[model samples]
Structure formats: structure tokens, C-alpha cells
Target: MPTAPALSILDRSRTRSSGSDADAVRATVRRAQRVEALGVDGFWVAEHHGVPGVVGSAPTVLLAAVAAATTRLRVGTAGVMLPNHRPFVVAEQVATLAALHPGRVEVGVGRSPGFTAPVRRALGAPASADADERLAELLDWLRGRGPVTLRPQVPAPPVWLLATGEGLRTAARLGLPAVVGGRLLRDVEPLRRYRREHPGGRVGLLIDVVVADDAEAARRELLPQAVALARARSRGEFGPLPTPGEAAAAVGSAGLTGRERADVERYLADAVAGTPGQVRQRLQEVLDRTGADELLVASTPYDEDVEAANDARLAALVPELVGGLRTAG
Candidate 1:
């Protein structure tokens, strides 16, 4: 088996129509606690704005709660969208958090716009002519290499770019880590380009996986999340994740559209789902293919109990696969 890389998490803190957002936030807090107990290297909170289906609108505040709950896990965003907030304000927030937590803090940034046009208008930030230029501006502000003094004056924590394409090269030039998102499942060319540009630059992979007692149970747990993503991608509708029963009923319903069925199946087929041993083997396969140094496991099922089981099984995979596992960072 390929070596198990540093394992971490990227929690979306998905909310259900059946529950309040507060329930999701509490679940997120408990999740970081579990990550610490499981000895995972880091816990990353995602940032989504004006999306009813996702409750992690403010990563800084959510990360603060997470950092306070766990002493061992490196807490950070998966990331904060640069276009949504002023660079200096973000720098201050991150610096303050890092000052409070010291070495336990990290920063990750991205250029993703909000889910819809109204959201963009609400944030009052237009798309940058060049995201890289904006990213450069943020880095300069955070690094304080310029004449102006950045307040708090705390040591800047490690900053990672959630990237692909030229963004990988940009991160390389900046001498920082690149988090390859789940969109490009196990793609290595970006990582290769990054290393070729800046040898020894850190690379992390984020992908979805579900480990259950059996294949049927695994698919059952993965079904709703897969359906939700497909709906977002194919229909541009951010629908609440359906219950597993709802998903199954949709599959066989007279109301099921051809396009929807295909989209749902595509995501379902793409997810890694099986027994614990099988999940371990497949994840190692991804590691072997990508040569990534770390893995940010991204699985946000609507049900907390399902999520807890999935996380436990995931944390156990590497120890059994590699004979023994050490704490990750």
C-alpha cells in the first residue's frame, strides 16, 4: 500500500431543512473534538455565504470555536474567499486568531464567488480582473513587507491556497502549500507543476470517502451527499440534502428526470464507498497517483451520527494499513 499521508478534515457544516443552523454549528464543534481524540493532524472549516444549505458562512468565527475546543488539531479555514472580505480585515482577524492560539492556527484563501448573482451583489465585491493579483495583494498585506504596519503584529501563520491551474504555480511562487480540491479528484499534474516550479512545496489533497460496515450501508450513507452535489452542479440549485430514503425514492420515481438521474449516478459512482479495508486501499491508491503529502478528508453527511461513524472509520484506516500511525499536522 502507498504510505498514508497526514490526514485532516474539511467540514462544510451542512444544515438540513429539518434542523436549525445552530444544530449544525454545535455538530461542527463536536467534530473538532472528535478529530483531536482521533489524532488527525488538522481540522478545516469551510466558508460559504448566503447559502441556506450550508451554515459555515463565517470561517473565522467557526474556526475560533473549533480551536478552543481542541488543543491538538491545527484549526483553520479551507478557506476564506478573498473577494468577499477586505484583505486587511481578513489579515487582522487571522492574526488575532493566531495570536490567541499561537502555533495552532493556519490560513487558507480562495477566489470562489458566492453561489448566486444576488449573493455577489450582497457581498458588494465584483470579480477581480485577476485573482492572482488580488491574492498577491492579500499576501503582501499579511506579510507586512510594505511600509504600512499591520495591526496585532502577531507572527503570520502558515497560509495555504485552495488551488488548481495557474493558482498552483502562484502558490509555488509564494512558497506556500496548495490544497488540491475535491473537484479534481486525485489529479497530480497541478501538484507536479507546483513542485517543478518550487521544489518541496507542500501539497494536500481533498477528496470524498465513506467507510461503512458493508457496501450497501456505505452507499446508503453516501447517497444523499452525492445527490446534493449533483443537484448543485447540474441544476445550479442549492437544495437541502435529501434523506437517504428520499434519494432512493427519487431514483425510481415517475417524476425523476433523465438528466437528474444521470447527474446523481455520476456523483454516486465517483464517491469512494465500501468497507473500512476497501476505503483504506482506495485512498492509498489516490496517494500513490498524486504523490500528495497530506489528505483532507471531505465528507459532510446530513446526519451527525452517520458523520461520526464515517470519521471514526476513516481515522482507523491508516493505522491498520500502515502497521502504525503517528499524529498528523
Candidate 2:
């Protein structure tokens, strides 16, 4: 069996409908602590604007908290959506984070247009057309290649571009790592192209992970995450994650309607859920296929107890699985 790559994490700070958003934030911090102690290389939080389902709106702020709470972890945004905020603000914030955390900070940038028209309008992001320009501007600010000086003059951290569409080419041109997602699992000519263009450049794999008693059991534990995504697609609303009971009531085997059923299937298809042995096998396949240099686990469990104790479970499960693989090798 192939050994797992250096592991990392992506915490979406998904809030439960019945709990406070602060609960999610604090939970993410705790997860970071566990990730750090478990020897994960990085812990990345996301930046979503006006999305109720995700409470990690201010990634820099949350990263600062994560950094203060842990000493060794590389803290960063899975990405900051560049178009949603001013480039200057991003440059300053990242620089400040780097200054505070030193070599332990990472800078991942994304140019995703907001999820909805209202969100885009609220952020004043023009259109899909603006993404490339915004991405370029953000890069210029970070790389200091442009005329503007990054205020305070702290060294910027390693930049990772969230691989999406043409952004792959940009990351290659700049010699930055690209975080490859499962959505792009079908076609990774981009990652291949990236390595060919920038020899030996690293690419990070971001995948959904769930570890429970068994494959079916793990999938069920991850259903809330799948269901939350389905709800977003079916309703155009990204509200808090529904409780397992609530999700099962709405989209269980017999409850789903046309779009809901389709959405649920699609979301479930992207996840990797199983016992340690099963997860290890599937992740080995992913690693062989993508040849990704790093692995970033994105967990979305349904049970409130599981959600609250994710860090402990993941801390125990990941090491056991990875170690078992390595020992076998």
C-alpha cells in the first residue's frame, strides 16, 4: 500500500441549525488544535460571504485565532475569495498574519464569484468576468511584483491557488501550488500540466473524509454534510447544516423529491467514508490517481456528537490508518 501524503485539513466552520455560529467557530479552533497535535501539516479555513451554512466569513480573523491557539500548525484560508474584498485589504491582512505567525502562515487565493446574484451584488463583485482580473490584482499585491509596496514589509507566505478553471494556468505560471479538489478529480490534466510547466511544483488534494464504524456507517455520519450541500443546490440557500434527524426526515430514502434526490446523490458521490482500512484504501487510490503531493481532509459529519468530537476521532483515526499503511509497507 502506498503511504499517505503529508496530511492537512479544511474546516468549513459549518454551523448547525440548532446551535450558535460561535459554536462552530470555537469547534473549528479546537479541530485546529487536534490537527496540530496530530502532526497535520496545515489547517485551512474557508471564506464564504453571506452564506449562512458557513461561518468562516473572515478567514484571516479565524486564522489568527487558530494561530494563537496552536503553536506549530500552518494556518491559512482554504482560500480568500479575492473579488469579494479589496486586494489591498487582503494583502495587508495576509502580511499581518504572516508577521504574527511567521513561517506558519500560508496564503491561498481564490477568485470564485459569489454563490448567488444577491451575494455578488452585496459584495459588489461584477461578474464571472471580473474573477481573473481580481485574481491577478490579488497576486500582484501578494508577490510584490507590482509597483505597490506591501505595507509593514513582512515576507509573504507560500501562496496556493485553489485550482479552478483557468486558474490552474495562472498558478503554474507563478510557480504556486494548486489545491486540487475532487470536483476536478475526473480531469487532472491541469495538475499534470502544472508540473510540466513548473517542474516539481506541489499540488494539494482536498477531499471529503469520514471515519466511522464501517463504510455505510461513515456515510450516514457524513450525510448532513451531503444534505447541506444538496439543500444549497435545491433551494439556492446555504443555511446552517441540518441535524441528522432533520436531514433524514427531509431527504432520507423516501423523502427526497426530484431535484433533492439528484442533489443528494451528487453530493454523496464526492465523499470518502469508511473504516480506517477502507478509507486508507480509497485514499490510496486517490493518491495514485491524482499523484497529489499533499492531502487535505475536509470532514462533514452529521451527528452533533460526532461533529463536536470530530477532532478527537480524526486525531485517532487518521494516524491509525496512515500508520497501519506505512507499517504494512
Candidate 3:
């Protein structure tokens, strides 16, 4: 099997109760620099709007900040929702960032469901039905195949599709690289089909991970973040996601009580939560299962203290994982 590339960090900060938005952005920038110093390959920003806990509404803006702060870490959006904005505008934004950052910019595009009903309605795109077509149009515009010219002569940034299940098939048909998360119920068959059909594209997998000295503590801290994700997905706030209690738990204690926590623990055992050694083993298992060429680690914290600890753990884990993989090879 081909050894996977070095792991990359994607900053998906859950909105904390105390920190202001500026504080969170600055903190994210600091963390980006720290991770860069530790030899991470890249950093990705997510786009989430109208969510109380998610502050990364504009990934390009955040990526620009990250670009200015760090010298070597490649920066990009894990994706920009295509259907919500004009293709020309997105092309220009991405092109401008790439020009400013030179060869260090990557553009991952997706059709997002925004965050809330009001926000989606405000954007004038309440559904993702036309996202694929919009993405295709955007690609054409970026590649200079469209009739209208995208000025400023921006070289197209490498575009990656955030795909799941049949979405992978569409990505393959378009000959684009894909970044897939584990929320889809289907096996790696989508990836296999993508490779078999396209033969020239690439695939990256995103996994929620928390590696620390205390395994149970890490899981406890990660539960709220997982729960938030579950609720968001169930409401169709984002793309498809793993059913709650299957790989994650609810964030708040609305229905889940003491007994519920135990059940959640049992349900989420296979999730990537544990000590460094155990987390590494779980990652390897995921790799074996999917044969993904790249992995994006999304680490979250239930609170400030846990966030700091998780960041430190990630700082230590990156080099160790990369070095071990290299040595083993």
C-alpha cells in the first residue's frame, strides 16, 4: 500500500462561550503558526455562517490572515460553498489569494447548506440541488474554458471537491481531487470507484481526532463538539453525517443523561479518541479501511482548557506520526 502523506491541520474552532470573534481568529492564527513550526504540511479553514459556535464564515479571509502569519504552511479553504456565491466572484477571490500567497494556496470547493434556515434563505440558495452544476461552471470559469474572462490573470488554484458517496462519482467525472469525511455510511467503494474511473485524481479523508495522555478525559471533552456536529447534520445544516451515538454524542444534555453518556461511550469507541498511541492505531485502521492518500485532522474541545490541551497533543503528534511513517517506509 502507498504510505499516506503527512497529516495536515484544519482549524474548525467551535465557538467558545467567552472569547470574542477577533480573539478566536487571532488564536487560530497563533495555532496555525505553532503547527507550522511543528512541521505540519498545510492548514485549511472552514466556511460556516450563522452558527453560534462556528466563527469561520469566510475561509478566504481567514486563509489570507494565515498566509500573512505563516511562511511555509500551505493555506486554503476546506471548502467554499459554491452555490451561494457567483462563480466569477469565487474565482477572483481564490485567484487573488493564490497570487498573494504564490504557490502556497489550495482551493477546496463544496456546496454548503450554510448553518441556519434564515441564513440559507438569505443567501437565496436554500438547497444544494444545483451545487454540482454550479461547481462545474466555476471550474470552467477557473480553467478559462468559459466565455467570460476572469481578469487579473490569476492562475487557477488546485481545486479539490469535498465529496461523499455519489458526490465522489461526480468529482471523478470532473477529474478533480476530492476531500471526503467519514460521515457517509457506504464503505470505501466510492473512493475505489473514483480512482478506477478517473485514474488521475487524488483523495483525502477528514477525521475527527483528539489525542492526549488521558483517553477518557479527551473523549468527555470531545463529546459536545461531536454532539453539535450530530445536531447540525440531522437538521441538514451541512452535508451528510454519521448518525448521533454511532460515532459521536450529543453536545448538550437535553435528552442524554448519565446512562446516555455510557451508551454514547460504547457507541463511539471506534472514533479516533484516545492516547497518542491509541489514536495513531485508529488512524492506521482508518487508512487501511479507506486507502486515502491524505488525512485532515479536525480536533475540537468542549472548553478552553481542553482546547489548549488538544492543541498541545496535536503539536506533539504531527511530527511523531510523520517521522514514524517515514522510518517505517
Best model per lDDT? 1
- lDDT sort, best first: 1, 2, 3
Badly placed stretches (over 4 Å) of model 2 are: 1-3, 126-129, 253-255, 308-329
Tell me the lDDT of candidate 3.
0.70
Clashes of 2: 0
- Check candidate 3 and list the clashing pairs: 15-53, 227-251
lDDT of 3 at 261: 54
How well is each residue in 1-329 modelled by candidate 3, as lDDT tens digits? 33445677788645554566676677778778877887778889988876656778888888999999999988878888887777778888887888788889999988655446677778776465488778988888888888888765678888999888777888888888889875641366677777788775766778777876778766766666555554454444422222224334243435444555554554355357889888777776666566566677777564555666676676566443322121111
Q: Residue 5 of candidate 1: its Cα lDDT?
A: 72
Candidate 1: give the clashing pairs.
41-328
TM-score of each: 0.92, 0.89, 0.83
Least well predicted 10-residue stretch by lDDT in candidate 1 = 320-329
Question: Best TM-score goes to which candidate?
Answer: 1
Query: So what's the TM-score on candidate 1?
Result: 0.92
Count of clashing residue pairs in every prediction: 1, 0, 2
How far in Å is the alpha carbon of 61 misplaced in model 1? 1.1
lDDT of each: 0.78, 0.75, 0.70
Per-residue lDDT of 1-329 in model 2, one digit per residue for the tens?
Answer: 64446677899888888778888899889878866776677899998777788889889999999999999998888888776778778888988988888899997888676566787688776565576676677678877876778876777678888887477788888778888785666576766677678776777778887867777777677777777787777677778877777777777566566787777777677777787777767776776667776777788665546754554555565543332121111
